[model samples]
Target: MAGTVQNREAFLNQIAERLGRPRITKPVERPNWNFRPQDEVLKSATQDELLEVLKEQCKRIHTTIYTTDNSELSSVLNEVVTNYGGGPIVTWKDERFSHWGLDSLMKQEWPNQDIHVYEWDHTKGEENIAKAEQANVGITISEITLAESGTVVLFSDENKGRTVSFLPATYIALIPKSSIVPRMTQAAQKMREIHQNTGHVASCINFITGPSNSADIELNLVVGVHGPVKATYIVINDL
Candidate 1:
């Protein structure tokens, strides 16, 4: 037993030595855009008109909107759980998420209903995958996404587990409006900055647009084959 343990330790040390330490990269310069502009215009006569447009879009897309005073993150999450038909809601093991009152919401909203809240730290790899596979909806707070093309970028990290966002049936992302950029190039620049600051780059960086969809067979569009069937973004302007 002692010999076996020594062998195992030696193997682990060899692997660690081979892996070495993570080295940080220098930040890359931002790219320039030279694209032609399209002539798309929206003429809204009143606030009611603009709201009507937003409502129509939301309804057409089968999405729900919950606005809170930034202080009411818990209330917003609670309302989402209640209205969206209770199911497994997956989040990361981040303090901000907990501080925003996800734990309380989980306790209150789950037991009474058939819903479950699964939190993963990514270190629990196989366990996280199991939870993600069984989950109905995955909730994540993104670093940024582009509004024009409706693109969400996820840098692989412990808190923002990639499987939680990709394996679930529905994905609900909470993004602060301030994080929104005008173009994808800007998003790439931001990512490069993050990579420079951190020594290790994410194992995977996923860019999601709309939901998992394909129009491969007979030109018939199919959804949910690759990932979530539905994707919703809750943009919090305040936070």
Candidate 2:
């Protein structure tokens, strides 16, 4: 094992030497792009137009979109639970969730249901992961929404585990209208700002356009093979 490690290090050193420099250590600024965003495919759009485009794109990708207000959020989630039927639930432990009264709402509405709230405790991580995997529904907050591709971006931190978005049969995201961006480029810039403020980005940033699907086998489409089979985006206009 030591010899193999030495060989790998020697190979990497040789490659660095051939490049006439060592690996980058400082934060590098990106070079100017040749094309402009407006000149290219994407352009600045009105909020109404973006929402329309996002809705259409989401439908095309087999994602459900529901527009609601803060007062209706509990009902929205309750409706989802009713439609989804009985099963375990996993949700993010975000303060915003409580601020929005989602935690109390869930408890009030789903008193008998098994609801697992994600926390940063490493001791319970394994158990939480298992619960998330077995859960029928997983709900979390969306950091940003890309209107161009109808994608919801999630930065996975301790409060929001990666499995909560991927390991369930159905995933519901609470997306604030203000979080919607014109495209992925803007979303990336927002993520960079987050990294700058936090001193580091989340371990995984997921871009989920729709439910997990593939048409690999003889062009026959399949869903939920690798992740949630169904996804719903609840766009809170008031938030």
Give the whole-model CA lDDT for all candidates, comma-separated: 0.67, 0.81
Model 1 per-residue lDDT tens digits across residues 1-239: 22434586667667777889533335778677575343122321333343334344545444554444457766776666565566887876667566555666776657567677888866777889889998888887767765445566776676778888879888887666566555466677677887799855677788777567778869998888998887776666453
Q: Score candidate 2 by lDDT.
A: 0.81
Q: Model 2, 1-239: lDDT tens per residue? A: 22434587678778889999996546899799886754344565767778888899998899989998888888887787668775578887778877777767666557655544443344686887888878888888888999889999998877678888899889899998888888887887888898899888888889988899888859999998989999898998853
- The clash numbers for all candidates, in the given order, read 0, 0
Clashing residue pairs, backbone N/CA/C < 3 A, model 1: none
